[model samples]
Target: MLPRPPRTVQVLALWAACTATSLLILRLGAADTGATPWAGPAPSWGEHLRFWDAGWYERIARQGYPAVLPVDGAGVVQQNAWAFMPLLPLLTGLLTWSGAGFYPLAAVVCLAASAGAAVVLDRWLAPRAGGAASLWAVALVWSSPCAAVLQVPYGESLGLLLVCAGLWLAGRRRFLAALPLVALAALARPVGVPLTGALGLWWLMEEAQARGTVPRAALARLLPGHEVLEARQRRGLLVLVLGAATATAAWPVAAWLVTGRVDAYTATETAWRQGAAPDVLPWLARSATWVGPHLGWLLVLGVLAAGALVLSAPGVRSLGAVPWCWCVSYCLYLLVFFDPTSSVFRLLLPLAPAAWAVGRAGTRVRALLLVAGVVGQLFWVSWVWDRTVQMTWIP
Candidate 1:
């Protein structure tokens, strides 16, 4: 019998097909505002997808962060390039520094990085979820609902790549190696903040177990903590956790250092909230306003319940301690800090571990999800890329 193709080859082929399809769908149509799809005068098809947050990245890539923060009439800092992470744009800027355009070259970079993310995720999940299950997980993730951003000039692709690399390394008790990748991932996106908790939880498990000296009962199942790990491993794990903390702080510190303002990053972030506090209340209000005041709390409770169910599923739980912690932490971060928005879907990309469960979920279920996800991609690509939807959605 002939040998099968390697998993990485399969992953790349799937990625290429999806990327080509997404670009084709985008090129064939821009966005229709009820009348017809609006194809703006952007030089290429990818340019149509590069707007909103892409515009901010393009600005950052074209000209670095402004030394002076832009402010409104009321002395409030308005949204600016500081609100977005620099790594994606800075990397993209490398190509554009030679006079190439921003979005097209960025599209290439994002495609390559996201491919790396798929391969990492494939290897990362294989041990925990068998080879077949891991392949299914990768397929589901690359073709997920908001897969559009995977190809666009967004941070999600590169950030996810780094985040998964960090998770893969950290899971194997390779703390020292994971730290710099985690830091670079942090530099790419806000997702690094949640990764800190993932690493911290792993450290706590190992550190607490190591201190016990007496063997821990296996039931509680504190992962990365086994009978074999020594004092040195525990110490290295602690370093990983602290390094995650420092990585999360790098952006804010850099923003402050550059702009010479203590509140540069926070002020810029809050500009979007228009002074709303970071809490569940804003999310509740948004939900209530969207649905109704009476059902608002129910809606919030329902989402929490749904997340609990999803995370607790056998497949997700099988992802083991570090990845599961990341899923929970990222969810908590979104719930606490974010108000509901269309962009929330894209923010859920890091939750790909759940797809492991979804993948193992019966063949029929996987097929259904794939179909729904494709439909979602078509809708999201056409809907979000359309300029008119920009007023209501942030994808």
Candidate 2:
């Protein structure tokens, strides 16, 4: 058999193909919906990228966030730009300050970031799974459900890019270099809270092993111990663990400082849900309103069990301590904090590495799975993404 092209070339070709097709589908979405006589012609791709949270990011780009939060007569915070972090908009604004249109420039930013993420993801996966499997893994990420988010003016692509890059760096014990990337990743989409947890857990495991604690069998699945770890690497891990914690806390603290309210970020985020009462399990509480308390709780338990099984699968665990820890920590973060919505799937995009587990199937199985993913992407973008005709569902 002939040799494959360079991995970067293969990855970009897949990225371009999937991206162009997704844009074509989004174009179909932009056409006049027959809801109004004057709905007019389809918009440019730049305009097509402006749906959903793009509006909020654009508001942040054009104008700085409000010093004082907006509230209704009842004194509850309203949904506003504070709900978004600044990096994507800040980059868009800086690039467009010279008279470039926001959507067009922002589109370039998102697309390029996505391309970078494809490259970084491939690099991260190759050593563990070999070149061919890793290439297929990149394709799976680009074609997964809600992949259009990468093509739009959103933070997931940029955040994932920096995050994967940071993980790659830190995995080699280059913790100093990983610091800024992790902090920026946090600002991109708030994934840092989970990242911090992952690193803290990893470091704790290493420290425990070094101190002759945590039994080898109990820690067997977690990580390789300190036998190979040097003092410098341990120091770096400690520094990185501290930095990740601070980075994870950065945005919420910034919001607090600017708004003079300790709960500034949390309050703005809840506006999307119209606020819910305090609960030990907010996810269960929200689900109960839809499906009844008993079934809702069963659903919650089912979700947790499903997540645990998926993470423990051989393929997923093979992604190594970094990806596995991040995946597990992120699931915990979602369970405690996330309110169940159709949009919850969008929040799960960072778990794309889990695709590697599924990629380890037989050739025919992989092919069938790819076909299923394409079908899933079609419905996901149609029912969840294309808001012009299908405005009832949130992606």
Clashes of 2: 0
Candidate 1 positional error at 318, Å: 1.3
Q: Write the per-residue lDDT of candidate 1 for residues 1-395, one digit (tens) a residue.
A: 98988878987887777667666666654534333232345325655645668888888877889788989888889888888988888888678656668888888789889889888888888777777777777778877778878888889888999999998897787889998899999988987668887777666666665677434664145432233457887788788888889988888888999999988888888889996668888878888987899998888899999988877766676667777778888888898888788788888998887787677778888888877887887777666655445455667
Quote the positional error of residue 352 for candidate 1 in Å: 1.2
> Per-residue CA lDDT of candidate 2, range 102-205, in tens?
87788888999999998888888777777777777777777777788887888888899988888878877889999999989888887888888888877777
Q: Which stretches of candidate 2 lie over 4 Å from their true place?
A: 1-4, 32-41, 222-228, 277-280, 388-391
Tell me how many clashing residue pairs each candidate has.
3, 0
Worst 10-residue lDDT window for candidate 1 reads 31-40
| Colliding pairs, model 1 | 31-37, 32-36, 32-37
